[model samples]
Target chain A: MANIKIIQGDFQQRLKLQFAPGIKAGFPSPADDYSHETLDFNRDLILNPEATFYGKVEGDSMIEAGICDGDIAVIDRSIEPRDGDVVVGYINDEFTIKYLDLRHRKDGYIELRPANNDFKPIRIREDDDFEVWGVVVWTIKNWRKY
Target chain B: MYGIIDCDNCYVSCERVFRPDLKDKPVVVLSNNDGCVVARSNEAKKMGIKAGTPYFQLAEQFPNQKIAVFSSNYELYGELTGRVVEIIRQEAPAYFRYSIDECFVCFDGFADTNLKEWGENLHKRILRSVGMPVSIGIAPTKTLAKMASHFAKKYEGYRHCCMIDTDEKRIKALKLYPIGEVWGIGRRYAARLEALGVKTAFDLANHNETWVKATFNNIVIERTWRELNGIDCVPNEEMAKKKSICTSRSFNGMITDLDGLRTHVSNHAARCAEKLRQQGTVATIVGVFLNTNAFREDLPQRCSFQETLLTNPSNSTITIVKAANEVLQKLYRQGYHYKKAGVIVMGIGPDSPYQPDLFDFNAEQFEKMKRLDAVVDRINKVNGTASIVLGSQQYTRKNGKGKADVVARSARRDACQSKNAIKQDFKSKNPTTRWSDIITLK
Candidate 1:
């Protein structure tokens, strides 16, 4: 079975890292401000803390969308799932990581397009069991781990 | 206007979220221990499958129909409910979670925006996000919003979102709505109202307020009547901290041993303490109760209840579980087959700046317990339920043999490590909360 590990990210103890404005590879500049305002990753990445969830991508269906296998997809249910939005959706009782195509102008139907050309797009009928689980707000790619 | 979003067939919907094939089918969710039908889908209701019908009687009720029956999976339901609540929290300016399946939202600043359209969007969002069908009712009062939600669910013309905006619409909706179906009006009041010629919500609303108050002599009824008349009498801040929290469940089978009963009681106590901490409250009294199978006429009947008052109010699971076990010892009967057990924490108060006992206060132990609880709660929050449980709660028959064996220091560690300690055979994967249970695409 393909596994999608969901780890609840802690928002309480947020790490605020100080970043130099422009790091010069040649030499360290003394003119640069020593004490820069700390940037909170939780605040910058997560728009809605309560509604946000982390789902580990299991398949390469949305590889073209930068959500490759083993990547962590940050889903935000609070955000409206719009056309062209990459969404975690349920189709025929199974969940899929796909891009929602609502521009077809079809009544009571929408297309779930897989990013990889190898996979065919799923045309969901109104009567068919389908649901857009949440909109993928951010994708964290693990270059080393994968 | 106030808007109330209520999930249609909440438990069944929660079940259907994982099993889409059960959609439009005769599906019913059984209560704990696979007892009775606690929740039924619309199709099941249409097929005359009544709620509260015993699971065993399903075959007799609908012999030929292939009914999809599932044991109640509260972990999944709770996680999904939290997700829905989170969405509502972000959408509404101000909101109150009235129940697991219902929430009351105030659109205070969105008066200029079309409320009907807004309600529709809210419904669609929830349906899409959580796979739970919710009906939205927008009205001037919470009670009316509830009534409007009933109409939204019952009739397809409303398109899952009904708004009672104008006086004309209110009057029309209320006239069609029976007095019994009104928010706070129960069967007793409905019968009384009917006798007094108040057959519908419209009739009750049109009645003289002073006369109705005098007749009922009840504040809630008076408020309901006022609310029906478009006066928002019910306070929006109705979600108050609970005074008492009780956690109880029926066993899968009758537990004859005291150790088994202790394990269940400790679990309940731990849950109660966790709840108290969630609300930032401490309980002064801890109560435990155990009862033999009431349904079995052949077995000996025994039921016992015991409670103890603590010198210091505490929300620590260790303290509560220790106290609960003491009460459980008092309640436990050797021969009786105990089918159910419960733990109730009462006389709850705010936990901030706890007043220590003058003579018997252990500052070091109190701080230690607080830290212990916080760590356990945090771990459990991130890593599913019961990842780390009290050793006392893990004393099962298969592993520890009995309470006497579990009391041994060496045996306690072994019991805690046992996989069969916490029974969760009926528990569904907590898709939203647990890492392992998250839906995977292949």
Candidate 2:
């Protein structure tokens, strides 16, 4: 039988040592063909070339879109989001999905308005700070039966 | 062109695959044992059958009509759907399951390839391989594709394939189809739009975006309007994980005994905990509830709910069910035939982000118990559900005989062989087990 003992001393060093070939047996490794770290590391490589990876969408404002509480959206980096496009954008390190309100303000400001009435439009603080991850080329929603 | 393929008469098709004798017949799958019409075939609908019509009502309407009705066979439907989607995934570079019956496939930049031919191939493949007929709709936008798919399903001679990519084709299709038939427009919204003189898809498309947005300020509605105009406003997501995991089911019969209630609650808690584990989240609160059939006035009715906080957030079934039992007792009252007993685990957080409890038991006993529970769960999952259950469940089921008998008559007409029912019927009355006897006590 294989030893299933968990060792949690100096995790960084232990993880680094385990990366070496012919490392000693018995570590807190997940039970899979590939280690947890290996899968996390390969996530970048496994991404669809045509698709852009936008992290989790936060808020129930767009629940009618079937994009509920916590859902990760994929946007096509190539497609230019037109009017009414569901775009993933960054506003002060926070990511959100909303209809692109391209109408520039008279005061030299741009805003992205949420579909739900509960949330306010995210006003562009600085032109340099705002970065659109990608235009949402398609939306994949959940099929919850219950 | 984007293609949307929808399964035709899904529940009836699923049933027909198993019972081939019912092919091309007017079949209607009932919600639960001739309760109401949940799924009906094209043949049944032509015979003036309606969805959600009470089975008794349908029987009255079609006294001479041959209607092969069957209870909803979820296992077969789920299994067949898995097979169909597998065939789809094998065919398309990218695919999205819009619903159980419908899936959208990307044929992006198919400049030279014959799109209609491709759709026909997929339709025939699904029909031949899975024993189910599917209609395909191809259009410039997903919304139009969905609309066209519905038309293809309703109409004959479309040869299971319909396309509306060009303006001429789209106009012809829209003129013939109703405005409410569009993917996102529902009855109330359609009525409002119709009140505004927008009676068809062509009229809706002819209206400016400003007016549409003014009427429907929600973002999804605006996207729907855009999609109607041939713009892909909604993007595709590769991985969409579940937000909340719930495990609940109405019991075959009402359970009055406290032990039986606890057993059902434990079972639900365990199932929900497993779901949480599958999603890589740990629930901090377990909500347990019990309710009686509100329609039944013969018995005293009661409904109660209790949410218990966990010391350490976990997805372990043992830990969750222990919490569920505590809530079950607090909610349980005397003399109520409970139709449903359920547990909903919420306040989910990432497993790695949890702060470990200080001054918690690190005793060897606790560690051993966890390891044992893990082993049991692994065995149960691999073998079958309830292949190995807690002793409490066995004791609880023993005490539930009186309540089970009340609903046993209605349950037995299904012509299904439930393993537990056989075991329950065979067991000698009042048979008991002694713990010491296992060791050959003399």
Candidate 3:
């Protein structure tokens, strides 16, 4: 019963943060004028605004892939899911984040491999209702905010 | 060539995006107020469920079958439609959104390219991007393109894209396409054409142009005949400004009180004004109508309508709501259970550089109102609808109370909140538009 709700991202009010030069532990270098260029996070991260969707991770099955519980997964439907790519897939009408394995695809079946060793690889039968919803482009975890 | 990309079972497809479990199951989307079936999945269609069939009839029709039913969620469908349109805009050189579920694209420069392959890629791109299946039909004319789209949807062999590029293919396609199924031809014209031995599109194309023109005496049918013959008679439809705008809805339950009716009327009026501003148009006339349920024979039925002409055209929500409220007051009748109310703004024209009123001219007041409307529209657009509405439109419902008591409490609350209060019970979430409804995994 996990329904993915997609909200449109506001691109007009983009925040551009200045990338200040890093300070070394050995010595602190003078701030360079070249480091004043600001970066637009939305432009850098989101390749396709219309096709990109954000979903929160629920289970720990994909913890090995750095997509832990409560992490936000950026799924891009525009990008084709390649073999071994982390993908958000719909199986039996439920969404699951897993590694897509195409090695055994020629045998007329696909495999959804969970990142965590605790979970077993799911063998997708030809008769099973399944689809690759999108490729997980990025994952954002709230390290210290929470 | 013009290509039409139409989402297959649009409303059903939208619902499936959220509830994939509905796949391979009989699903039906009900119309407003959960009255009748507005859309049905392929399985539902196979089960003999028809569009506009009353929701109550489903049980009688399929006694033992499991069926998934959903009320019309326009907010979700509208957002998904926008996403689909955005994808189309990026893929096609130029496009016209024909409707919520369909778009017409022109392939002007890519004449020598592999059109069939291009169509397939477009189909796959939309499906992958939006999770909605679309059928594409490419032809020399819009009418023919529409006909080709029908074939693309009907036959699986087409692989969701059917292109009629050559004259031979055009003739063959037209031969199989019925006159009734042609783009612009309605039932009346279809019957008349069939009586005149025009059973198929091929037959219509074979007739003499002069004879067809003299027989039908309609420019639209003439254009269709020309289009069937591989001539692009219908140009790309331009987005034209509307002459009038209306916002109306049938309530979930009947209301007998005048204040209750006023709430819905003001809401409709505000929507009409918002639409006018969206289109950069102003209305010179405002109309309001209220009607009792026609199906309730046991109750006394009454219907009334009234309109007011403004001295100066305006797109202001306050002005429109005031006019609508005045008309609603005039149309209101006691001892009637009103089932529906509506507001319409007519005499629409360009909003800018309007002629001021001769007797009553107030520039400062108009400026202030315009600024207020702009702020309200911006807030509502960014925060989802009803972030701010007319004070008269506020309504409240008491929780944990009996039906009769709840109604009485709501009436009292409405009277007190009419000055200024915000109360809403929007059961359906605007997931795409509202930040609060965004999905969170638990």
Candidate 4:
């Protein structure tokens, strides 16, 4: 029995410390029945872990839409892009963040509308090699500026 | 029923995820050290780009063709494939990853379900979520499911999902499948089977058990025959116990000294030990292999491998690294330029409650080693990989551009890197894993 030891599931082991949650501290609190896990961005906010990707915003492409440079965009490829949705599109060998404007579908071409007035709208003639790479689900901004 | 989902052209497909422009283009990914083509896209396959074609020969053979080339980036491949596996984890009733690109699922209770539609929808979901195209195969046994996946990849009519549910379908699939391609029937057995006038899976399945037993007395071949005849004989334990862990790398350049070779072997040995501990296993043997580049015909060529048995099977990095260095000392030749080297840990089994020899059992030291290893594993996980590597594992590395952020702690840190850092000149960005390399949206 010299070589006996614990094995398997070594990663999920936790410290055997005791603050004693079961000690009935302060009358067990009134909200004990409804206690649950806290909200985590990785688990709750991101619905599709497989399809989620992140991109850093640049060039003030969507500045008027409150999506500024240095912000992080959470893109979900599994989501369907709809009219007035902020989406990432690949064009001219780069990813451009823009609003998907499908209101002109009867005119035989859709447009990638920009949020800032300084930038012009990019239109497709229905013959171009183009696709909306992913839809923007959320954007995180750093207000404190580290 | 059993289902196998295999990533189509796995490494090349991983490379194409970030670069959507590479779609419909001829692309191939090279092995470590930019050695040779290990993966080829369908378009590249159509252009007759064979796997294992050396890097230099690609330009010579296809003079005027436009083909995309990539160095194998396992970080990207592993991350992307992990996403695919995550989707499978959500969709499949029960599954286990067979390899990096293949996953086996047991559809035990879904008797009334439409497996074909289920497989098709699974494929669609994976492709949609991960941008990875996978082929699905469903059958009564694992072997037949693997064979069906091949048909799903070959013919478009299967819609990336093939099922061998009926006897007629199984018989037809067996007839069309070549003998050499059958699972568990390796090359040696395939040659023996072909010599006996058995050329297809159907040929082996059609023979009676007495003939199979009389012809080949091997149990593995017999199991293949039985599985081909619709018997489920493959065990999950065979998949669970990896049996061996091999870590090898072709150097960026050849090495002529024993010291440099020792560093490479120690790194590989340490890697093998880490892998063993991660899987909660221990290895009873430590093997080392050294070889010269066969392509350099002008120079002398030599290749050899030798292993040493341990007094006690161990997964400790120091123990394995020391054993590997001892073997390397015997295997090394003074004047040969070694191009590649590797360490293999075999005879692997569960680490808990191992038997110890009466003469070599040291209980106190074993406890110390376990505590040390656990702390090292934790430190490496938090600070980043290889942060507290063994002294023997330390080697000065070439500063490949864009990777100049080596921690500055000592004079050794500032010293130039070892000459044999792997040559991955065409490795793409790790946009998915690294924050500094994430995609830029304009």
Predicted complex 4: CAPRI docking category: medium
Residues B248-345, candidate 3: write the lDDT tens digits: 87776688888778878998999999989987899999999898999999999988888999888999999999999999988988899988889999
Per-residue lDDT of B332-411 in model 4, one digit per residue for the tens? 88888899999999999999889898899898988899899889999876665677877677664454222233343431
In model 3, the Cα lDDT at residue B82 comes to 89
Which runs in model 1 stand beyond 4 Å of their true positions? A1-146, B107-113, B166-175, B178-219, B222-226, B229-231, B236-238, B304-306, B353-365, B403-427
TM-score winner = 4
Per-model DockQ: 0.30, 0.01, 0.34, 0.59
lDDT of 2 at B204: 83
State each model's C-alpha RMSD to the native: 6.6, 23.4, 7.4, 7.6
In model 2, which residue pairs have backbone atoms overlapping below 3 Å? A137-B235, A138-B234, A138-B235, A138-B236, A139-B234, A139-B235, A139-B236
Q: Which candidate leads in lDDT?
A: 4
Model 1: per-residue Cα lDDT at residue B166: 96
In candidate 1 the C-alpha lDDT for residue B196 amounts to: 90
TM-score of chain A of 3: 0.73
* Global lDDT of each candidate: 0.82, 0.68, 0.82, 0.88
lDDT of 1 by residue, B1-442 (tens): 8999999999999988767667789888888767788999999999998888988899998998898887788888887888788888877888888877998898887644888988888788777667789999999999999999999999999999999999999999999999989988888988999999988998989988889878999988999989999998787644547668988888777788776677789989999999999888899999998888899999999888889999899999999999999988877767888888999999998897877998989999989999999999998887656768877776553644555565434444454455434343345666666677665753
State iRMS for model 3. 2.6
Alpha-carbon lDDT of model 1: 0.82
